[model samples]
Target: MAKDISVPFSYTKDGIYYFERRVPRDLQKHYSASKIAYSLRTRSSSVAASRATRAAQQLDEYWYHLRIKGSELPGKHLLRMQQNATKAPGSLLPSEHDDNATVSQSEAVAIYLRLKGQNRPVTFHRAAERACGYVIDVCGDKDLLGYSKADATRFRDAFIERKLTGSSITRIFGTVRSVVNLAASEVGVNITNPFTGVYYDRQSGVIERAPLPADVIKAVQRECMKIDDDLRWLVALISDTGLRLAEAAGLLREDLVVDADIPHVVVREHPWRRLKTCTSARVVPLTGMSL
Candidate 1:
């Protein structure tokens, strides 16, 4: 019955919890309303808290997409002119009159999502939309077949001009390529995906993550023990088990195999939380406080 202070929720007469958040001043022009309010539809505090967190995260991602869409890509003018020059003689941009030429890039994104987005995480849909949106912003949304290797090269170059890390640029190309490939296959079109095999330095401007020193980890664990609160318990759990924050948080009580020969925890995807990688699902041995 205690209120969760981390998530902002208000109660109604019926004990239903709801949340309201004000849209930031800069992003207000994108919405007709100034705030977002929605019912969590649950009286239980825990359920309401979870729902509130999810809602806030989704809104943040949506706002991020809007900002990305509104901002001009670096070197966009030069990229657009180059794309126009490289187009084939009869190729048409996706204009009001070009609906029947072929499946446009934006349409390809839609088709890709509709076919492959079922039960996928929100990031899956966003990645496709963001990548295709980048291309559209730089080179104009043309027919799927209209994009040549030159266009793909230009897209990569635009990201470079934007100072995005090489890995980030490669991931964008991966999403764009998948969308184009799936759409072309579904429509029985024989067009090659120009986004494929676009070369970029995958390590340029990348900073590798350094693990915490052993002494630091041990000191943190000691401090966690001294604090001995729910949050510290979670930290200790992660420290010993090497589980990601979301992975450990999403674990069910039954996921711990304490009575087995080797005490361990099973990490897997849940309806509320998805693993970052396909191979992320594994059994991690527990030690120290996690045991």
Candidate 2:
């Protein structure tokens, strides 16, 4: 039998935990969320619990604020400008209903860019902005809390219209969602993310990278043998050892264990370049033209 799975503010599926809730219909207009099925973005239940607890705290405060305001908060649940003159003598003011921070999608993207800028490359930041730009274009500007499943659906349809592959579309959605989620969590914004469950069509549209044909490799090798430059050696090295373009370009003379019992190329980080991942740092056995 399947494991009996239950938690106070979360649920598990496929080894990942998700925060789930059904926003009361009367309160949905104010929160701008119908249902919350946000992935805590973790496989570990403990981590998911921590994240879910934070989300739940925010939601609880929202519910409390709603009850405190009673029926005074007006029209389509929009917070109207203060009308002190029209108010009952001792009624609670609109100011009292200011329960959460309100950030527009544009403003959130700016914050995301600023916070992410120092750590990541400019190209990465630019790509993130483009991804966010597409979202704002499709969804229209709204407060963070105002994003909904309808917006996600619209964005998905728009991407499909553009003929973007499922992987590309999913990546665009996921990037913006990640930015929003991080910003909301870090900046103490109380919002339910619509993009969490709006992932792209899975796996099918992923185009796998294939290796060069043996004849093509041979043709390149024959040509590289004629050129007497670093390009020639790079072509030769990859042709035989299959080293990544960066790994070959970033190589140092010391990284070549040519004198060892079994010659190898040590794919390690250098002052000029770092391995993309820890696993990228390894010893690749050398042979053929690479020797």
lDDT over C-alpha atoms for residue 22 of model 1: 78
Candidate 1's clash total is: 0
Candidate 1, overall lDDT?
0.72
Off by over 4 Å in 1: 1-101
Candidate 2: tens digits of C-alpha lDDT, residues 93-136: 11335666555565566556555666465566667767776665
lDDT of 1 by residue, 119-231 (tens): 79878876877788778756666778888999989989988987899989978888888888887776666777788888888999999999999899999999998999989
User: lDDT (CA) for every model shown?
Assistant: 0.72, 0.68
Which one wins on TM-score?
1
**lDDT winner among the candidates?**
1
Per-model TM values vs. the true structure: 0.65, 0.60
How far residue 199's Cα lies from its native spot in candidate 1, in Å, is: 1.9
